[model samples]
Target chain A: MTTPALEAKGISKRWPRTGAVLADCSLRVERRTVHALIGASGSGKSTLLRCLGLLEPPDAGSILVDGALAVDQGVVAADRSVRRSVGMVFQEPSLFAHLSALANVSLAPHRVLGLDPESARNRACSALDRVHALHLADRRPDELSGGERQRVAIARALAMEPSVLLCDEPTSALDPLLTREVMAVLRELALDAGTTMVVVTHDLDFVAAAADSVDFLHAGRIRISGTADLLGTRGLDDELDRFLQRS
Target chain B: MPRVLAPLLVLLATMAAAADDGMARLRASGIMRWGCDISGGAPFAFPDPSDPDRVIGFEVEIAEELAHRLGVRAERFSADWLALIDALEADRCDLLINGFEVTADRERVVAFSTPYFRYAQQLVVRAEDRDRFTSLADLAGRPIAVLNGSASIESLRSAGVPPSLIVEYDDSLAPFTETILGRVDACLQESFIAQFFAGHDPRLALVDAAFDPGIYAVVVRQGDDDLLASVNAALASMRADGTLGRILQRWGLWSDAQRELGIDRGPIIATIPEAIGTPPEDGLPWSLVLWSLARAAAMTALLTIVSMPIATFVGLLLAIAILHGPKPLSRFCHGYVLLTRGTPLLVQIFLLYYSLPALGAWLGIPELLTWNKVVVGIVCLAANYAAYEAEIHRAALQAIPQSQWDAARALGFTRAQTLRFIIVPQSWRLSLPAIINDLNSLIKDSSLVSMIGVQELLAVALGIGKASFAVPSMLVAAAAFYLVLSLLADWFGQSLERRARTVGTLPEPIHR
Candidate 1:
């Protein structure tokens, strides 16, 4: 029905000496759903997320968006139309230092979307408001708190109006209060915008609170996939259980 | 009316009495300070090679002879002809014995002794050009270079030579060399000096005809008749005893004119109808100073304006190529820097100006650019500074962070775009101050162009000094001009630096 919003079929990646970080991994995210990818530190969850986000090209298999092949048979198209449809939030705050938070959010839209300066600025302001970060729109990244910075980053990503939003441990650097605030914002954005979301994280509390579905990744392969309700009760292997306890 | 006349008469009488008192004061002092040129140019005094402090020349010998005859110990100081009048006016010296010419202009400020030698302006050309130009008429429309302040320029100008054809030089040697190098058709000098210079260099030969016959005389402070009479008496006695002849012979300056005119024998002639014009007090020629500055300004501006852009562009490219090119290419750029920086600019100029044309010919490149000595000098200066500017730009580029590059790449910009939009703009601020300093130095260094006969400011001043024998004054003026230029350059550089920092507070984007 409307074809899964994003699908990665047997995606795999290997480094020269490090061998495989993602091995024949497959993931499918339906429209208006949040999928939490959970695994240990050395697992292939982040690599899979990178592949799904189209930030990294997979060595094998294909990525499909709305039933159409976006990355086909290990070939990423020269034109980055897929990237424009997908927005990514990095683990570290890689915001451009020269621009204000508002400018940071507005840059890509004005540059790639051909939005005039006034429209781009207005869109950037609304994006900041969505994250409850409108007041800090004029502030530089250095002037913002860690939570405020993460919120601004999310606003920057949301301003692109992408179909799929990818988060790489977005809340990993935040404290408890800040983490809750950021997760709440992500949940609100997912539900209200009807956007497909994929998050690579080890935070079970976040998964329980926001994810509609979950996948357990181990040693570059997906060990299990199911509804989030089954996360703590069943279907977990001994290694995953141990990994979860350690986290 | 009677009272006014009485005061006027009294004032005149008082001035006369003061002059007498001043003379009495000088005689009582028993020390007659004589100023003379100390650079060895035959008749002019120069330091003895064995003892650098002790001077010897025809003028020095004459000065000592005059002082001995005056029954006073002569204390000598090196003096330039231009400053000799100033020195006497300031009481720094009681007499000037550095081949003083008896110009009427000089008589306004100082009195003169009977002329010791009959000096005539003569034309000099390369030995090969000797047959081409027999007299002044031969060089009427042709370019003829002459030392500034020399009687030759005046004679040549008066003889209907156009101002544009007369290339004035500050240093006589350069003007002479210019003729030898075929840059100028001819040069003019005093007959004795021309003969002396021509004898030393086989490439040059003197013409037989004289342009202007001026007399060389000893000068004393104006109203110092007693000092002038004493100097005249000593000169006459030296002529009688054949001492002047012996001095001239030692300098290889003994001539038939000295013998025929009885300049070496007694009865010294105080005046001669042959003396073309009144002697110049201070005998300082302003033309030489003006010509020197004009040439220096043109050359320095040419060197700075033309070479600076080339140097900056080439230097920046070199720095970037060295910093980012493949290993082999970078190594070559580094080697170039080492080679250029290791040598002196003067040596570089000489090689480029003198040797490169030959090399170009051997390489079979059409000599489209051959023998334009000024171009050679400019290229040499540009090449030399290019090495330095490259280093400066390299350091500035390296100071930028690699993070900038990575950020730009992450933003989907290509490598070339990143460099153009990001790296270069940032490096501009850092490289500007040093570039300005290099420019200032480049302007000053342009004076070296004179060696290639570019006829710049210092060269012009030197020519004037040589011609008028006013070396000290010309040097001072040249120094002042350079000082003013340097200050202006420095101010402009500072303003540019300030403008570069206007965007200082803006965060620089990272471009990989």
Candidate 2:
């Protein structure tokens, strides 16, 4: 009965330099859901996720956060307010290399929310603890390992307390053990806090094992979508199935 | 026709208004501003040894007396000795009481008051060579030093000395110093200058005869007859009261030439004033020399420090504007950089400090920005270095990775925030070494400001060298000071760079 936690309708984008295009793609994630948008490289899934996070505005699209219009067609609904409601974790850790892990995680709340430093730092600490990265909080990104950096990055997003989180390949650079650990942390955040997450990845195995819902993106559109169980039985559209199998 | 005639009449009225009000202005203000160049040193107008800030010379004493007789407070305006006429014409000062030798070329530009001192050019040679070069013809093949634009040039030519064999110097004392250093065989300079600058040294001796006697006088702007009359009357009274002779006597400058000119016809001074600093020793006094140069070194350091921040700030804004501003504004910044960097710094200083005021006067604009020598030096130095700094910043900014901007913006930072937090810090770190190198160059380039009349370290050292004829040693001391100042700047810059590398954190020093 509740509206999906995040929704995109009719998203499209184009690169003027090379004439690449993403046409008419849409996706929805339910409250507390672990949704994976799966596609091969160059399928435009990462671009769509970035557009949903408002990092790059889509040429055309409407994005909704908790059924409220956060972006209408080409215009962003609000700048900091809309961005505050939706958080994103990049494919790489993308931590501010100049900052300590704690400062990196606390920067947005301190800068955007005008939270006093102490409270912002405390909130950052709690977010790090959520991802079990408390030990790495004082270290710089250069000092942290691949998995620790990702975890700190996740903490950076979680500290913002957004309604929806979009992550692009959050486990792409990790080993299998660290991948499982990061997945487990994400699953726990979804289950405990009822936070919705939409992850873009080519990891079909990750989708099959961890996603509550799945969308198969090909070319520029979501070619197939269903609950994981249904998608597991039905398979993706034929071409994408083969593509996913190869990836 | 009437419209044209009306404008012509207005123009004539304005010219009439501009006519000489010199004496009236002096009376109204109650201050007789004397234009002078204290860097001329010693017998003319030089820094007092006991208090270097208080200038003292024979001319300084004469100006005080003249101002007293005229019932006004005396004020001294320091100008480049070479540019004193320009200062007088600019109405920046009323009289030039510096050792202005009367010459027809100068009289064509400004009126000369009655002769205050008269002297013939004296030939000076090293003590050992005093017997070798007795007459001008004896110096036929050897190098002889003469002041540039002095009456001695005509005397040397008339003496049958080949023009190519004579070395001319623009500075007042360079000829004498060059002679003492044996860079020239002999020097022909005014007799009074010989007494003060070269006569003190044991190695130099003045030949008994003097040549081409000339008078020194107060210079007033042409057409300022009212001011000229008052200055002449003051000179007559000083001559009557023996004040003029006493001042010349104190500086050890009273000579036969003054009596021959019929001005100082008073009794000859038998004893030199005890206050005259013991005649500069045979060579430079290194201890006192270093002490004097240290003050100049401090001034150079202060100039560098004050102007560099301005250069850095201006360079930063210029770089940002060139890189990020709209098309027209960016183009303007590019043009500005090209113009400032393309021109010689000396030319820029001259244009800004000298030519610009002339241009302002021609344009009839009031309150045009004319600054003192030091300020003009700083402004020109900052502006010149700013162009280089801007280019450094631009290259550094461009070198910043795009990923940094993406990361900052992805965190919801505005464009300005992203630039301030992510881009500028990295760019500045990348550019610090280059900027510091430029700063070292700027410190050396600061000496060029002296040409515009800033009495910075090198200028001060040159003055001492001129006074003592110890150019080589004084120049060596100046070189050491500049070397140390540059080294200090380098060390400071490296320390800053180390701190910047740690991203604003002060790291603990490493110990073995």
Mark the 10 consecutive residues where model 2 chain B has the least summed lDDT: B503-512
DockQ metric for all predictions = 0.05, 0.21
RMSD to the hidden true structure, all candidates: 21.7, 6.2
Top-scoring candidate (lDDT): 2
lDDT of 2 by residue, A30-108 (tens): 8888888877777888898888888788888898888888789867876677677788888788787666788888877
lDDT tens string, model 2, B1-512?
11222233223323432354789989999999998877676677776544344567788889999999999999988766766666565555788998788988777667899989987889999889989888777877888898766678788887888899878886767776688678998998887777766666687888888878878899987778888899999899888778888777777877656665555546656544423434444545566667878988887887899889899879988999999889999999999999999988876775566544444455665236556778888898899888899999999989977766666666677777666766787788888999899889888888888766677888888777655545567788899999999999999999988878663262111110
Residues B1-512 of candidate 1 have per-residue lDDT tens digits of 11222233233323332244333555688777787644324336643322222455667767777777777777785433443454344344567777666777567656788877777888887888778888878877789987665677777878888889989874445577688889998888888767655555678878776657777888776667666776777788887787787666666566677765455643332322111121245444455446445666666677667888888888998898898888999999989899999977765654454344334434444254245656876788888888999999999989877645543443444456556555776786789889988888888887776554455566555544443435567688778877777888889888877765543243322110
Give, for candidate 1 chain A, the lowest lDDT window spanning 10 residues: A76-85
* Cα lDDT, model 2, residue B404: 65
Q: Chain B alone, TM-score of each model?
A: 0.50, 0.84
